[model samples]
Target: MASPPPPTSSAPTGFSLRKIAIPAFGPSLLFGIGEGAILPIVPLTARDLGASVSMAALMVALISIGSLLNNIPASLITMRWGERWAIVVAGIWSGLGMSLCVLTSHLGLFATGCLMVGMSQAVYNLARQSYMTEAVPITYRARALSTLGGVMRIGMFIGPFLAAAAVHAFGLQAAYVIGIIGVLGAAVVGARIPDLPVPPHPAGQDAPATPTLVSTLRDHRRVFLTIGVGVVLVSAVRASRQAVIPLWAEHLALAPAVASLIYGLAGGIDMLVFYPAGKVMDYKGRRWVAVPSMLIMGVAMLLMPLTTGFATLLMAALAIGFGNGIGSGMIMTLGADHSPRHGRAHFLGVWRLMSDIGSSSGPALLSLLAASLSLALGIAATGLIALVAAAVLASSIPTRRTGAGGAHEK
Candidate 1:
């Protein structure tokens, strides 16, 4: 085995959100708007092109599948091209994909376009997450990351409203154009922003000695198999919430415009808790936030099928938002926590690959269950899985908390 490398240099001193995070915020916001604007409408668009609800959901699932497939490539790109360039390129790519979606009239073509957007999302997100992990001080890791997640939520809160307006003015297909605009705008912003300085490599490590992906994955196999699995299930429940809610709204015969509006409103609740959740995780422990977030989401999904009207469903959506919002950045945070500092990009790539697997499969699983049994039963089954995930996380994660109020991980 190679001798342990010398201690790495510290992150830049003093944490200022304005100094560190603000530069990246604009691109994050714009990209989130682009994605959020399109996501709620993807299933609706598929339905318009002669798809059953299950098939429509599957079309939406393609985004995650594309993301899953692209994780390693995304990581490789980030490692070689650097974060700034990768993000700018990703935005341009996503904009092109959205343009395809806007121009296409067929469901298959539209789904293909969305697949490209998903691939772009994976690259863009990996760059941003890797940047955050490298730049921010460990003590403030959760807060910084959570704030980043909150910014995305803010954009998401705004996106559905814009989508509703676009649908009203043009048509469901025209709504995709909004995403194109947002993505191009993001690319412009990202291009203008400077790349943050990453922490210096450990001494004795040559600048040219970047580690290979295969070796990194092999080194981190234990964490990847155990804690990583729980993170994937957590991601599944999160992705399911996104996929299930709008579909559930459609199932209840709510107007597409109205459904988008309610989903947007729930996102408002989601944006509200980012900082507090980060604070809890930093001080109280990961389990404090992780367990309750999963439990709340699981219970809300269980009750989702029982809702007969907009009001009851709206309550369920809000509950889900509460759960999701509190856990904003949780998966990424966990990945950062476990990743080796030396080969972080490769480890994160595999880490994200696992989560994206859950993200991709969650919708397919839900759709399959809906087809095999009933829609309600499918949702309930996800709820059960989520509860089991909560148990797995609570049992597996160490009870360590950092900073002044830090406690042992549990």
Candidate 2:
């Protein structure tokens, strides 16, 4: 197949990300903050609403389910309305969802609201990624997407503290208020950004007919089956990291506060590495970061089984975080790389669906193993998955290099 054309930009010489940063990434930050603020409180509120423990856990899972269900629909919406408006609509939709959570005491109504928020998240996330894929030059693509990832992480990090303060000052429902503010804020920001002009076809040449999601998937089956499977494993390992640290910490009998501190420390390290990782991907290659990231995480997971104390657990957690952090934009970047210009949104929707599948399944796989066999074995299974992810990525990622001008050549 012919190489994809280099991305075109209308910006003058010496383009800087600052010009598009707020317009491109601002809404994501606001949306993330709201989601984060409400996330920790979801189960607590569900319990207060009289849900059983398992049912409350299901309530939390609804968000991922909602996201998974809406991926294709979200892509359709973005394709129809364009990225900016899609984001605006999604933000407003999420705000309304949060409103339901805040206003309704009915358990069913509350669950519906959680589902709405999750669905909106699917649209919101896909829109931003699609926008960045089109708007950012390929040379800077990794860095731009990494920055977007980092920005969201910062919002999530800030959110719980805001939730804590709000809950303390008001009540449990007050946390939803923060979420309401966040989504609405994102909507407003999204509405204000100028719409990106549709890229023109060559003179005398007509634009190609838009492709359907089914057709796009059929055409890209090879990529989806190969690199896409790798993506699933990558996501699975990453999601398992969240469960492993806390579960293992509990097993080791560490204090809850100490566990939280260690988790927070690992998160801090995770947040710090995004830019450097992206830079390496842009300058060297995707494999430079992707392979090592999985390898490190795999090694960390394997080591986690042996940690018997706080210090050792901390070391394991930090390794997991670092491994995850360095690959912050790996999946998004890969999706963008493989996405056809004609059906980019549709392709991305499917790509994210694959990712969400891994995210939803990873913890369940760990739990199943833990329940049926042993915790150590469950964690080790994830480690094995991570190692497999590394091998798949190393072998499958094309060796094409992106030049300073954003041109790619094998």
Best by lDDT: 2
Instruction: Tell me the TM-score of each prediction against the true structure.
Output: 0.84, 0.96
Q: Rate the local accuracy (lDDT) of all candidates.
A: 0.82, 0.90
Candidate 1 lDDT tens digits, 1-410: 22112222333456666786555678889888998899889988888789999999788778877888999999899888887888889999998888887787887788889899989989988888887877766667778888888888788667877988999999886668888888888888877767767667779966755688878877777777777888888888888887788889999999999898788778778889989999888777678888899999999999999999899999999999999899998888887877766677788889889988887677778989999998999899888878988998898666777544443443
| CA lDDT, candidate 1, residue 320 | 91
Which prediction has the highest TM-score against the true structure? Answer: 2
Stretches off by above 4 angstroms in model 1 are 1-13, 40-59, 103-112, 166-177, 198-209, 243-265, 303-315, 405-410
TM-score of model 2 vs. true structure: 0.96
Off by over 4 Å in 2: 1-12, 403-410
